[model samples]
Target chain A: MTLSADGSRAGRSPRRGLSMRAGRRLWLAIFLAPAVVLFAAFVTYPILSALAYSLYSWEGIGRSGFAGVGNFIRLFTTFPYPRLLANAFGNNVIVFVLTMLVQNLTGLGLALLLARNPWGARAYRAIFFLPVTLSLVIVGFLWALFLNPVFGVVNKTLGIVGLGALARPWLGEPGIALVTLTLINAWRWLGFPTIVFLAGINAVPEDYLEAARLDGASEWDVTRRIIFPLLAPAVTIIVILTFIGSFNWFELPYVVQGVSGAPNRATDVLGLLFYRTAFGEVDTGLQDIGVGSAIAVLMFIMLVTVSTVGAVFLRRREVEMG
Target chain B: MRRLCTAMIAVALLATFFPASVLGQEPAKLSFWSWRTEDKWVYDRMIRLFQQRNPGIKIEFIPFRAPEYATILSTGLTAGRGPDIIHLRAYGGLETFAAPGFIAPLDFEQVPELKRFPLQTIAGARSRKDGRIYGVPFATQTLVIFYNKKIFAQHNLTVPKTWEQFITVMRTLKDKGVVPLANGGKEGWTLEVLSGVIAPNFYGGTTFFEAVTRGQTTFRESAYTGALAKMLELRPYMPTGFMGVDYATMQQMFINEQAAMFIGGSWEIGFFKAQNKNLDFGVFPGPTERADQIPWVSSYADGNYGINAKTANMEAALKFIRFTATLEFGQMFTDLLAQMSAVPGVVVKNPQLQQVQAMNRKATPYIMLVGFRWQAPTGSTLLQSALQGMMAGTLTPAQVGEEVTRGLSSWVDAFRGR
Candidate 1:
């Protein structure tokens, strides 16, 4: 409800105070120009530029003849051979699934316990949120050091506990590298979902819970009947954020495994591949920009589609809670 | 008032036009980019000395983390913006800088002091595209096996000359409850280092490499097969679950004597000395199967510097490159960085390096970015993946050979297709 200069409703004074309104328009333009310019420069420009590059075959920063969808063709046409595109997409899915199962559930469990006022819950919250403040690179590096087979605390501790035989390379093996990275990512970001869920649980009307408890409801029953349903909105947000993050995952894997995604590219993610194809590596010396741009376009489309669908599906489950 | 305003505007325009001249003979500032964080002192000393010798020029030093340097530099260059001078990796990395005109060719006549460096020592500094030397070569490194002399003595082992002898020595060390090798497998670079030492000896050195480049030979050939087989032979002697160990941990293992030998480049010597001053370590060329085969030591040019072609400070950049060859800079590098200078007359501070110098006749190309630049996965990637597979037991020597051969053929096809 916008007020006019006459102190009337908007429609009554739509054409009133023209000079002053012009001044107001000028001020609005002045205020918004910086943000508008920034959005155009940083976000809109790069996305448009990537879309443009996807149409052509370029080596990027060098001679670029029109390849015209050859990059896309190569990915789709690798029939008899294993498509790197499929492998990378599959890896992202695995990360997303594992994270949703392990990290989210863990976060929810922690949030529920904290809401129940467990012993030293405040201290435990701080401890849990500690890793969130750290940069992903630092987390990756510290985790890599711990997972190192030689002179690493993890393996050494395992040895001290007489589980020396169980001490194996956590990050180097193909069967476990992706899972390890997912777990590390979960460890770093678990606090976000945990806090969100906790906030949602707090916002749930205590009157409903109290009434249920007076009716001889268990704490678990109150939580299931009232608190959990109210947290649907938080669940929707977490699911969408997790989906986006899983596809865009790069830094941790890169810091730990390097650009090659070594041990036979066992840890190769789409982000790493996109970087390698676009810029090349110190060793490869061949930058295929066309393929890299194609990958970027695919990643953007996939992330948007999945996140939108996920949000829509999750939003449908969000009860009115009235 | 009008006259005064006009006079002030005139002075301001003049000031903008001639800032340096107005400021009483200020030095011409040049920006220098480097990633050697720990050895910042070496560059600081070099800059001070260079500044003293050339008083008219001042260089602003900017340091970045080495792992991120390549990406940052590439982005800067692509943006048509960068520092005046940059530190580049040797061989294939330098080629990209030179090939696409990111680095300008140096005027050799202006800096003839660079002649002190052996052409082969800085061969990696020469660009593959233009066949021109892009910058001054500062440091030299050779990859060799550094073994614990105390451990060798305890096991009553001698340096092996043949494959059987090497196997026997490894067996003796393994049976004595010592980790036989300390090679990091997590990053894939150490495996590359391992390939560098063994591949040249078995593959007829440079001759076979040239043939393979010309498409007359494939990696599936017996030379690569045999070398790769030998690569597999040494895997069992490593610590259990060695495939996941990284360089730092491997270094720790060697320092603690948990591992009897560390197969790394000369860069680790300083770290080794720092960790255990009394540690008795000896450098040896890696062992081979045939007694008659001369083992090849992997040599690379270090601290390779290049000038940005579009820089505003050409004269200052040239002076910097020239100063890299001076005895003063060489000594500073050798003393502070604990690495050898390829500048001919530089003093060798570490006596252990002298042992490596004696085996120079057996020196070979540090095989990376050499044979695989023409294809998709790349030569370094091919070898790294092959080595990783061999270690994991997922790939046999024959399978490794096939993988490399496939990469080579792809390169050949792409080359021909292009």
Candidate 2:
């Protein structure tokens, strides 16, 4: 009787334990179900479908014939393919560098200046951030109009200032077009970063600044060592966001230059090229869908890779101030 | 889990219920998509008239802007939710849509007035390989030289009939501190007309269109090279910051009397007139050196309406198209929009259009260069880019030609591979 009782106790304990575990798992699954399903439907399915599409000669309509790696092969050899890729990558890198250097530097400087509670600081913030809130399309069109050589305010003002020689076509010359576009891009985005950096600057305890000032530290030194270090998180966020935005850039160039990326194809970016390849233009017939898909896949891979690298490297520099 | 289940049930129920009556309907509502917002008044009137004429048929008008139209159309077709009829601008990529069976072939016998339209217009609408009519003939437009009469009178110059005279007149205007040509090299189409059409037609005589269409002659050997050379020669006479100006800005220069002459299509007449009704302007054929060869005129159907393959109301869609083709609708629509009709009996009263009509009539023997008439997709961009490059000084005339050849050949190979 004692042996049977022991055996029954052991069996009941394990069985009860198993049932409890099962119940816990069910609860966990129930909690996670919505997110998993949403992610699967939105992200995973589209990516897998894109991958499948990358192997076929589909025109985004009707029966898509299978073409395997032929599309990828054609992308390298086709008309201006190599040049197009180079132009896109080079332009993107240049824009990214320029934005990081100019936009961030200018933004940080502005934040520092504004942190001093300069006159009309509130009005200044509103004016500076206004462009950021406007649509990129509207900004592009507005800039295109403003930069018009004949009647544009820029050239007209330059002429009025007796600097007519310096007022050349901003968006037309190949050497200057990308630089001009980058500057415009920086101008548009600077406000967002400036606001964030200003918030970061404000968050720095006033006592620390006062202590540094009392310790005979110059304003530059305080900014460089204390405030700047603390503002690293905002800087990192801005950099990552900027990197992704630059890599995925399309609308501005598209609206400004149209489909040909004209003025000698100076403004052709990867997004525009991908679209042209996929949709075909007046001159080029429809590009092989497989090849276009491959280009898209490459673009996706590039954006993901760059973003990941940027996030990891920049996040490491983010100082968690105790 | 419960939320997900509820959402799924809702989606399933909606999907099932929405499509049931749609599937059961006969003479279903046919949706016609167009990128003609500027002419919405005329289109709406026509649609109403069509509906009044055919009470059994229901038509839905889906209008989008030009840029968004292509994306929307492609998306809708791919998703199996495409409209019954679609308006397609004449461009090179039509074959891609036709090849995939996303476009349906039109039976011309149903609308026999197809014979009255220009053969080139019909040719552009037909699939090159299968010879199937996929689009209804609509309106035709051509590039014409638009010169400001006030500027011309100021410079004491008349509309030049010869290429040499045109250059001479332009030089004279330039000497007077007036910009000769209102051109935006930033917009590649202006560059295309300057290099691809004007240059080649004048220098190569009748062989320009032949060489391009046949794909045997390189752009280098054609008069197109001469055109580029001429453009280079005339570059000094153009307005400062010519490269920076866009189509609208350039047109505004001409309209505002900042520039003397503007080369553009007939489509701009209405816009220009609307902007400045009193601006004295005259239209003339693009100048040519060889008067005997007949001034080669370029004209093509601007846009055509086609029935979607997935249309639920094919008969109703055809009825709408037939109604749209009638003389009453065609004339009224074309007149209000200031466009030359594809329908034979529709008369356009605008003097500029009358000049274009006369030119089209006179140049009937000369081959009309329909830039849209290409079976391959890459030819248009190739032409545009090559011309643009030449105009921008990045590419020489010979190099531009080579690029066109290379682009076309590569496109051919790509299409064949597909």
Please report the candidate that would top DockQ against the real structure: 1
CA deviation > 4 Å runs, candidate 1: A1-14, A17-34, A53-63, A74-82, A117-124, A207-227, A282-287, B1-18, B21-24, B107-123, B326-340, B344-349, B373-376, B408-411, B414-418
Model 2 chain A: worst 10 consecutive residues (lDDT sum): A280-289
lDDT by residue (B118-207, candidate 2, tens digit) is 677776577665888778777787767888989899768988888778889999998898888888777776676555336545555445
For model 1 the local lDDT of residue B380 reads 74
Q: Specify the highest-lDDT model's number.
A: 1
Give the best candidate by TM-score.
1
- DockQ of candidate 1 relative to the true structure: 0.41
RMSD of every candidate to native, in Å, equals 4.4, 6.1
TM-score of each: 0.88, 0.87
What lDDT does each candidate get? 0.78, 0.74
lDDT of 1: 0.78
